[model samples]
Target: MSEAATRTVTTPPGLLASLDPLLREWLPRQRWFAGKGRPVTGFSLVAATELLPSTATLGLYHLLVRAHQPLLPGHVGAEQPGDCYQLLIGVREALPPRLAPALIGHVTQGPLAGRTVYEALHDTRPAELLLEALRTQARIGGLRFERDPNREIRSGLVPRLVTAEQSNSSIVYGDTFILKLLRRVVPGINPDLELPLALARAGCPRVPPPTAWLVADPEVPAGAPQPVEPYVLGVLQPFVQGATDGWELALRELAKGEDFVAEARDLGRATAEVHTVLARALPTVTLGHSQLRLMVDGMTERLEAAVHAVPALRPHASGLRSAFTALDDLAAEGHTWTAQRVHGDLHLGQCLRSPAGEWSLIDFEGEPARPLAERRMPQPAVRDVAGMLRSFDYAARSADPPQPEWAERCRAAYCSGYAEAAGRDPRTDPVLLRAYETDKAVYEVLYEARHRPEWLSVPLTAVRRLAASGLT
Candidate 1:
């Protein structure tokens, strides 16, 4: 490696002092920490801010942070850990004078950080930020906090963070809010933070608001947020529960031989609503056909590469090109469509089926690898719609552990719901819709090959259907 490429990392001063050698070692070992493995010995805080205090009694400080910490080669795919931050939102009755021993040392911190001795047992301080987050979700859902999650979290409503393998941590509360925890911590507003906020404000249904995010205060000292650093560690919002994940649900329906045309329609309508909302919500930007063309061209190349690597996906390779060409044609028509925000990673798994047979979306935080700005930009909401419509097809076939008929019925129901809502007759734009589904399948083919090969057929079958229909 070059001199500059030795690959070790350092942190800002004044953070993680009390932990000593062990503390430093412990942080990197954490499942959530991206700077794991390579031994991030030093660090600094980019910013820090105190989150809103809890609404429920006994909830205390809620702080968000941004930090500049070391990068182990294994943690980041990029050259180095891009702008990232750490977040500590625990409550402390009285902050230790020395600030030693740390909060996460034990799970006890969130349960009883800063209240009277007994209150600590029933404490809501540490996770208080989450309590307030749940309140926001409840406000949106129009429900009251009938029971405390600390005690009755099971039935009523609870906002507790659930750890996921992604770069950050997640807090799923009331089975309604899903918070994505960003590990390598970055500063500035996150795309997920910005887009959802805009979506909620724009009156888009189905998608949740960004609500509150924990960013480090810019002026905080270096090395960790110090309970006061710079950078945002997590974004909190409403969670969607009891809803069948679109991917699994679709596959199940498909395995049972059910048509998901209706499900496709509902997804279409929701996507249209999102696009329509985006068109109005965002400042419109005019772009020539060049950008769209470039993107399509790139996607085509990616598809081909993926098919070559995985023979099963090879069959969809041509369909992918055809679909891209069709979308490209739409862009080239010179209608001058407006640019608005998009659910960058919009797809089947991103949505859910509520108990009411309704749908809700999760994961507004764009693709983790993309630049924050690009991911936040508003584009045709049609893109998201396209993503879902294609998903319906995936349902018709990809459902594993298999029920083909059930998948078909699900497809039909979903389509019915979406069409009734979007009002854009699928019949009117049959070609367009087919192209969208094919495109989506192509995307899936490539996506699964790279991330989860076992699921490759999910998209492959959809392409086969679209191609067999001679639609694209």
Candidate 2:
């Protein structure tokens, strides 16, 4: 018999019913919850498994629930499918003082009625279960825990939840490995695992390879066709001890009025190295006239949407449209550009510098809100360069009394470093580079307008400048 057959996998009856009221109130407030502004009208269970039976004093439950929300202003054909969320619920007879903050609420009227349920990752005992599962390569019902047999994980390591504000939750174990758990999940292979594993196989040192990972196997009816791929739930990778993210490093240097050109140049080289390896490991294609036209159209469409969402963008719409039109003009001339599997979302916050001055890229998941298929599609390497360039501009503007000259120097040095490593500078293709940058700025403007109204000026500043430049 298989190992999974011996272990009991069962969901406590009425567990979701008991937790519904609490989750409705608690889900929207979570930092990782994507439907922030929308109300969670209801939920439907996609899958549920009891990792530890609720009959025990301490229990753990794994749940994948679809959160239903109302559609936006425009009328649509049918109700859109809601976002799916992965949740780990911890049940205890009584809550202790330390676990107070993780509390969901006391279950009022079901099998777990009167028991306390909270976020399981916050409690060390439940958190340790994850490591042990990975260590043993356990399979519980639809959940599978996998690990690299070559890499030995010790029996016991203390786990602590990362408190940083992020779209996902991470737990660091013994300063050796960190497990990034995806809060909002979709089916298929996530690039966060796919790209790093590919790079690791090619002996690329720019990314930390995943040592262990979790996947949720889809459940299908006995006679129905099965899903071809599973959902990537979390990834465990080696932690870069005593490392600082590039964003914090840049801000600190800016605060001291120190020159950041050298560091920026080195970062550029690291990025180019990774891009080279990814190109060699994955498929690359040339975006011909038809594809290039489609890409340009996508950018233009995003700009129009942003203008509709934020009235402030209306004044700059025509100017921003020129950036996309320049690319369209080039495409009409039969110009083509190489596209490869590049980092979907590359920014200062995504790069880390170790104490010894080595750089590493993390979080290949791209923008969580974007569709998985789109994030995985190949794109021009300059798309990543444009993101980094915009990041430098953001850092400069965010400083007290903005320093435009500092940004210009850093941008130039970065391009120079990239040229040294990749043998071509992104600035050489001024039209494509400018178009990608303008598209990224439009994204930032919409994000800021929705989430941080006060920071709207940051992207608006870039909009005004990019608009004025008009693909110069």
Candidate 3:
């Protein structure tokens, strides 16, 4: 078993002497290691940022490793990386007087806050680098990380911010640049590393263009083995300033009973457009039925476990079972929807309405629970559209608990939108769209009931409708 499969421990002193040299052993011990749970066979340094002294461990490392993916490739595996992704990591700059609490072990600039190099940012005068980040907008997907909060009268210099998502707390200069420390890493194409480039290349009007990437070169530093693993990562792109957050925006529209008629319609069109582009860029590879069967079987087992986890979710097991059935049922109907690469998770909250009245998409990372492999599968574009419809319904249900009328409107607007783009021709007879919608609703019910109880109404309402209408 690899240390990745083991619990991460604080790095001891002697091992910290040479940060790079020890990383091969220590890196695997850390939680941020991206390469699934596979044992680290061997690793090579791909990139390193040591402009500072080796003792100064508070820099970043980009490491690459060769590991096993078990019966498959690294891209398709059960082990997934934790959320905190960054190219920068904190290192011990000097021998500790005794055992510095804050400066102990190489940690996230996060863990070493007021004690190490990261602490200097909050000092009376920040590092000169702060001046640069403060003055200009650090672009990463229309999100500019800035220094001046429009409140701070100090050195307008923006301190190179750590991502707000960090546990120790990195300030959000202006939500532009998020200095997320690499707390967990899963080997393969970093979504943050890969998404911006792909979307930009595909001309998917929503995401920002890739500006510059921060990577680690193992050879850049002396004897680093895991060079390609880019420990601390940050990507800067143009910021979409003053834009409303999609989640909040969705909530407001639902409350106002604002029929997202046109918006939903537009959403359908946008989804279709993006799918065409994604198919072109990623291109779909035919998924073997054996693989599909295994995926469906695995999902069934997982959903069964989920039902067991939360008793309220047990009733949903039947509906959940339906997803598996639907997969087979549809194919049985002689309307097999080929699996292809897809935007795993899509919903209203992942989209925004710019001041210019156009739809903008964000969060290309797919479903939070589904393994990356399943999420990357190209199933049906209708799945995406159905998710949005469920989202719209969810908003309405949450906003007006007493009104099913609103839910009805959501369903109409969404399908109206989807139909406009995907042709709504019911690829399968007897209008399989209802079954598609039901399939999505059942998923919504199971997922939201567990994660967001308050949002359960969206799927519940859809379920009621589905049960009443019959699963096509």
Candidate 4:
């Protein structure tokens, strides 16, 4: 880390006067910190709302912090500062020995300099306050807790922080309700909340609807040109009883050398059911010549970017580009595509198989790295199918010696089931499906190259196969 790693905060210094130094060291250690490997240039206090009055035995605070990172080379606009994050802070007179791990270091400066501070979500007492606030639909300072009127959150449910989570902090209340607190708070409507509500309204049973949600709607500065985007603080949903995520289920089956085609078929059907409901509930669009051109252009652009990011992709760039070009050819020949709201980022890990042998989808938040607006935009349902296919490929490759045949069998079965439920065969549109699959593989190539170099072969194989010929 360079000395330039210091955050050059944009907001007034007073807001974080006490916790600045502590957070500088603390934020980077968090998994949800988006600017990892980059120097935190500074911070701006977007909003700091006290959930409880200072006189309380345990003072709770909700803070919206913007962290700025130094620009990266050849990355346009990366130099711009401020990626917003949400934090729950619990202040106390003394830190308990058992809660030492949750400490954010002692606050040595600020109006409350002598107080001890830690992550509130880690402490059960403070964690329950969040639920209480939601149950009562309370507003403390700038924070607002809203609930679905038709739903009820039972009382006396013990709160436990889910430690294995990435990107956000989740608290499960006695295995009844799960609250996912958004760590990197983005300004706009979050798909995690929006999609589930729509699905629930459409009576889509494959997903559990949001029971309640929390948001921060701060007053914008006078004369600001744009409306202040409401920050999505957190969302509460019913906890799936005795559920195993699809990824785990697939892995277990792989280890057992058992056929997963049946389960895969069921998952595919559930996916199609959700898509059908989404298409009917939300706005749908038809991609004409111009729209298809834009879609192809975006895919090509991503391929070019991935090639540069991961040198291993350079060799297959031309072959991959052909897939995108084929989409244009289809449009030129009078073929049109339908676009609808989809699970923008779908994978086995994002689904759960219940004890009743039912498949339910979770996490409608799409790709977290992409802008919220893009995640919400209607796109071809095949994009989601492509994602699931890639996930199957990953599962097979991760197995001992790899099981290409098993993956192929499951893939075919899944698609067959999807066609049965969707009333349209995805294989019939090989050109569109292949393009999306190639794009997904390209994304995996870049991701695996950066995070798991050894795992590069998984997606690299798909890239070569997709670029060279048809899905085997």
- The best candidate in terms of lDDT: 2
User: What is the overall TM-score of model 3 with all chains considered together?
Assistant: 0.62
- Best TM-score goes to which candidate? 2
Residue 267's C-alpha lDDT in candidate 3? 65
Name the runs in model 2 displaced over 4 angstroms.
Answer: 1-8, 222-228
Indicate the worst ten consecutive residues by lDDT in candidate 4: 3-12
lDDT of 2 at 207: 99
Candidate 4: residue pairs that collide:
7-41, 7-42, 8-41, 8-42, 9-42, 9-43
The residue-by-residue lDDT of candidate 4 on 2-69, one tens digit each, is 33322222222364867888888899999888877887867788888766654467877778888888
Q: Deviation in angstroms for 331 in model 3?
A: 1.3
TM-score of 2: 0.97
lDDT, residue 244, candidate 3: 62
Count clashing residue pairs per candidate: 86, 0, 66, 6
Q: Write the per-residue lDDT of candidate 3 for residues 1-472, one digit (tens) a residue.
A: 2322222222223222233333334444433344444554333323222222323434322223333223324356663332332333334454344323223243333323332322232321223333343334433221223332332323342434432232222333344543332233333454544655677777778665544433322223456455434232344454455666555776777777666567666766766666666667775755455555665676566656656655656655575566566665555555444444556567776776777776666555565344544555566665666666666666665664555576566556656665566665323333335545665665666667655787776566666555554444
Backbone clashes in model 4: 6
- For model 1 the local lDDT of residue 163 reads 37
lDDT of 4: 0.87
* Cα lDDT for residue 296, candidate 4: 92
Which regions of candidate 1 deviate over 4 angstroms?
1-78, 81-125, 129-159, 163-168, 172-185, 202-205, 208-211, 219-268, 285-288, 304-319, 326-339, 396-417, 426-443, 463-472
Error of 2 at 88 (Å): 0.7
TM-score of each: 0.61, 0.97, 0.62, 0.94
